[model samples]
Target: MYKNINIFTDGSCISNPGPGGYAAILQYYQYEKIFSQGFFYTTNNRMELMAAIIALESLKENCNIIITTDSKYLKEGITKWIINWQHSKWLCSNKKPVKNIDLWKRLNITLTNHNIHWIWVKGHTGHIYNEKCDKLARYAATNPTYNDIGYI
Candidate 1:
């Protein structure tokens, strides 16, 4: 039987490509786990992808998961654009290389281990989990601890 998990994630960047952070809250019934990490340099989009990727990667076994995020880039990319991008050898419609390919690949591999549903919520909209994640992410971005190797 698959364990059911709900995840809330958010990412923040001090500037477009400056200090960044990602946060994820995982809830399994009455138990919850929070994860957050800061990177010295990264884009907001990369941080967003990292939030979801880290959350999914934390699971120890195949399970049913619902991932909620405030990033349309992440939600639409995974749910709507990934297949085509993969089929096209990771090229975007404009024939440019896809950005954040490393994180995207990580997310794809992690995804194969479970059944997942992606959800998108507007940021700063008073959604409880979303707001908490946003606060965590913002705090992390301002207090970065590591460099984002992929962004360097």
Candidate 2:
């Protein structure tokens, strides 16, 4: 039997607002691949969002994807409570503006074109793909020489 496509993504930054990177890995039975990008100046949240977006974008149109990430932001925003925010024009509970609205909007649009299942996994528990994603993200953060791939 053919298994479902599985993807895991992660992002890391040296500081809350510092050099950052995002990584994503996709697997389907016998096939697997990884994608990652880094930025010289960014936040962990941005990278996290980027990782998910990148992973989803890598899939063929309309293909169902089961995406796993450690980010409550991605899981909750996409699965739990994004509609309310969208209806409210991207404002938060305090009526304050949401951060990274651009990326959020892009991710939302990308998701609409594909069947995606957002999943949450505990971080740093020795899960092979999860750990690999973390390593890829950290490596990109540490290596600032890499060019930035902004908001794609």
Candidate 3:
């Protein structure tokens, strides 16, 4: 039997290259774990990716996970687009180096440790956990600055 985990993640940014934040909610059995972080300088995409990465990295052992995100870039990029990027040495179709290669690499490594099913949900809706994640992310983004992780 496999232990199933449900996760919801969100990201927020005041400006494209300004303060940003990410949040992740993990639900397993009857327990829930919440993770949120703020970045002094970051983008929504990076935060979105960070949300998922943080959730996966928090795990101590292999499990089956359902990861939900509001960003299609987060879902489709990891599941659909990354294969080609990996084959092309992290290059996009135009052969430009893929952005956020570091985070993507970290995510890829974390992914190898578990079985993940990606799902995309509409943002700003009334979904309980999704809304909670969004609130946490927005709060982190608008709040005080934190140590920058130097996302590229």
Best by lDDT: 1
* C-alpha TM-scores of all predictions: 0.97, 0.90, 0.95
Model 3 ranges off by over 4 Å: none
Return whichever of 2 and 3 wins on lDDT: 3
Which candidate's TM-score is highest?
1
> Where does candidate 3 clash, by residue pair?
none
Ranking the candidates on TM-score from highest down gives 1, 3, 2
Indicate whether candidate 1 or candidate 3 has the larger lDDT.
1
By summed lDDT, the worst window of 10 consecutive residues in model 1 runs over: 143-152
Over 4 Å off in model 2, which ranges?
Answer: 1-3, 145-152
RMSD of 3: 1.1
Clashes of each: 0, 0, 0
Q: Write the per-residue lDDT of candidate 3 for residues 1-152, one digit (tens) a residue.
A: 56799999999998877889999999999999999988888999999999999999999888999999999998999999999999999999998999999988989999885788999999988888899999999999987368766756
Candidate 1's TM-score: 0.97
* Per-residue C-alpha lDDT of model 2 across residues 59-136, encoded as one tens digit per residue: 764667889899898888878667888988999889987788888888898877566777888999988888999999
Candidate 2, after superposition: displacement of residue 19 in Å? 0.3
The TM-score between candidate 3 and the true structure equals 0.95
For model 2, the run of ten residues with the poorest summed lDDT = 143-152
